[model samples]
Target: MAEIQEKADSGKGGKKRAKKMSVHLDMTPMVDLAFLLLTFFMLTTTFSKPQTMEINMPVKPDSEEDQSPLKASNAFTIILGDDDKVYYYYGLVEDKPELNTTDYSANGIRKVLISPRIKSNDKMVVLIKPMDVSRYKNVVDILDEMKITDTKKYALVDINDADKELVASKTGG
Candidate 1:
């Protein structure tokens, strides 16, 4: 049978050599795996919405006579009473009062002042000053309001003036 098989060969050879072929891997599976990984990453990424906080930022008084430099075009003045009522006033030095409202709470101060300023001009600054005896929460509320209204330039007014010092000393400054 071996001799018959040898004779069946069309070509004569000393020793037949096996043919060699290149190996290839299918790339479709690899591409699918890459896409799956990409999808997982896309889904896992965290998207954070913007947030806000309230703070007491200081403002330089326009002059010693009155703390109204804080009332300048870029200032925001807020007074809180012992009764917990809040008095908020804001406007440019030259312009009429943009906002003046006394709320039983600090709910709408930012909505009234910050929103208007932001929509009016991107370069606007709001210097916030809370009165003495004001609740700490009032300051925080104002800051939260500013963040919501997108007020960027904000400052606190420190009571360093002579009158403020006397008042603080008398009332536990």
Candidate 2:
């Protein structure tokens, strides 16, 4: 509780007593000032911007001009198939390149991409070939994995007919 007190000495040669008065402290102005400051800060405060991946889109060619081919000898290909299955090959897709199966697990595709042989190869490139039956999330997951693994030299390639036939033979589809 707020207390106001006044003391006086009414003895011989004593002065007059101090008048007792109630202290009128209007908290309304202080509360209004606090609310104004809060509102001003809330209105002027900037929110953190959302982060996004920066992808440089290729400009369409005027005509079908031939471009330089990718080096298959120093390439690692990943083919996304139905049911979230991932097939990969170390080098070029030969007449019957051995297709290894893996998942999107922490120890699955991550292990392969982070291997010493692949990681140490500065000239190695990753080719991502997503099939028609594959989900859109499959592409996003692989792209995220590439970013997570720090694989910069990568490209999104179309699944060729040979690769389709090979996948069909393996998947029995």
**Which stretches of model 2 miss by more than 4 angstroms?**
1-48, 57-66
Off by over 4 Å in 1: 1-71, 91-99, 104-107, 159-173
Highest-lDDT candidate: 2
How accurate locally is residue 67 in candidate 1, as Cα lDDT from 0 to 100? Answer: 50
RMSD of each: 13.6, 8.9
The TM-score that candidate 2 achieves is 0.67
* lDDT per residue (tens digit) for residues 1-173 in model 2: 34565544446576666665665555787889999999999999999999878766566677766555566668899999999999998888773678889999999899999999899999899999999999999999999999999997888999998888878888887
TM-score of the candidate numbered 1? 0.42
**C-alpha TM-score for every candidate:** 0.42, 0.67
Candidate 1 residue 173 Cα shift, in angstroms, is 20
